[model samples]
Target: MQSEKLYSDLKPLLLSLAYHTLGSVTDAEDIVQEVFLTWEEKPPQQVRDVKSYLCRSVHNRCVDFIRSSSRKREAYVGTWLPEPVNTDKFQKNDPLAEMVWKESLSTAGLLLLQQLSATERIVFLLHEVFRYRFDEIAEIVDKSTANCRQIFHRAKKGIGPLPDRNPEIIEKKAAFAERFAEALTTGNIGLLIELLSSDTVLYTDGGGKVKAALRPIKGSEKIIRYFIGIKDEIPAGTRYETSEINGMPGIRLVVGEMIFAVITFHYLRDQLSDLFVVMNPDKLSHFNRMK
Candidate 1:
């Protein structure tokens, strides 16, 4: 009973940590369940902080998972976008949910984090995103406090600055996204071109299960052309709805109650700079099951 209660309390934090760390919802859920079973089997006798202990367990597991899965990711088909999570489904008023929403846990942000070493990624996320103290992070990563601080600094420098999350700016981006979605659905090529940056990039992740661009489509002209060309490919009875994906404004394509695609955007100067389209069934399984 106590174990169940503990798991209930920490599930949100642990899952968030693991998901952002590994960028795979299935893997993250597996790790979380594994950690929970381990905790259940061997209850700590003198743990001072249950949250910290559980977080450390998840972090350690994530690091190991990343190291083991590197080669598989390298060989993955087409562009590999992180699995999209529906932010609207998160538990309202939960601190962990708030943290997930506040930080750069977007698909693009997770892609950026993938560039760092496993340890560096963990350290950076703990200190920068989760606001863990260096001493706390040191214990979690099994490193000295000074070393953790150095690692955090180095990781920060390499990853560059985090994105701006100003409320007004976010509102403007949301409004622009609505217009972008409208233009695409309405086949307003002129409006679509105007909303896209000249050097815009679009990544389609089909995971080899379906048809998608093998390489990123660059330039507004190419992206516009690609979208226009693919209209006929969309299944009959498909509909579109604006949705929140990975804490960003996105569009969902559904056919008879099943989500077939999720399209997320990144805007620069109020124009779409980068767009990510995830049509991979594996990536959408968790999300689809929720609906």
Candidate 2:
């Protein structure tokens, strides 16, 4: 019972760490459950800090998962995207809710994290997102504090700068979403092109499960043509809902009973900078189940 209570209390934090590190709700949940199941069998006594212990466990698990999953991703077809989470489904006090301001929770940020080596990624996440000290992270990853600091520095420099993710964009996002939907639905290619920045890019994560651009569709004209080509696949009655995805305003497209895609946007210099389209069925299942 004590172990159960502990598990219940720390589940959110565990999920927070795992999901941010792994970017898969399904895998995060599984790892948390596994941690709790092990604790239940061999409950610790007089633990100094439950949160720290759980975080260490989750951190190690995520590293192992990453090592194992990289090969799987190599075999995964097409462009891979991180699974989107309906942040509202999390408890108000959940770290995911608390950490909404952090770029690590955004889809674009997660994709950038994927570029790091497993060790660098974990070290950077521990220090940057969770606010852990280098010494503390060193203990978790079994590296010296100095080594962890070097890894964190390398990760930061390598990732460079990410795009903005401001909560203040709510009004602008709604306006853009409305216009985007109208242009796409009405087949207004010219209007769509006009709304996009000259160098705007479109990233589609189909995972080869469905039809998607294997590479990013760059330039306003190319993206316009890509959308015009696939407009028929959306059909007429597919439902579109504006909701907060990864803590920012976005649109979800549902076809029949299935979620077709989650579209998120980034703006720069007052124009749409990048467009993200997540269509991996595996990635969408957890999001759909939450809805």
TM-score: which candidate is best?
A: 1
* Runs off by more than 4 Å, candidate 1: 91-96
Per-residue lDDT over 74-93 for candidate 1, one digit per residue giving the tens place of the 0 to 100 score: 89999999999887566354
**Candidate 1 CA-lDDT value:** 0.85
User: Tens-digit lDDT track for model 2 on 1-291?
Assistant: 377677766776678678877888899999989988877788678667667777777877888899888899898777777888876555354554455334445677778888887678778877877688998888777889999999999988876655445556657776787788778778887779778987999999999888889989899989998998898787568878776677666788987777789998775656777889999888998888877
In model 1, residue pairs whose N, Cα or C atoms come closer than 3 Å (at least 3 residues apart or on different chains), thus clashing, are none
Best by lDDT: 1
- Pairs in clash, predicted candidate 2: none
Computed on alpha carbons, the lDDT of every model, listed in order, comes to: 0.85, 0.78
Candidate 2 displacement at residue 146 in angstroms: 2.8
Q: After superposition, how far is residue 23 of candidate 1 from its true place, in Å?
A: 0.6
Backbone clashes for every candidate come to 0, 0
Runs in model 2 with CA error above 4 Å? 44-47, 91-104, 160-167
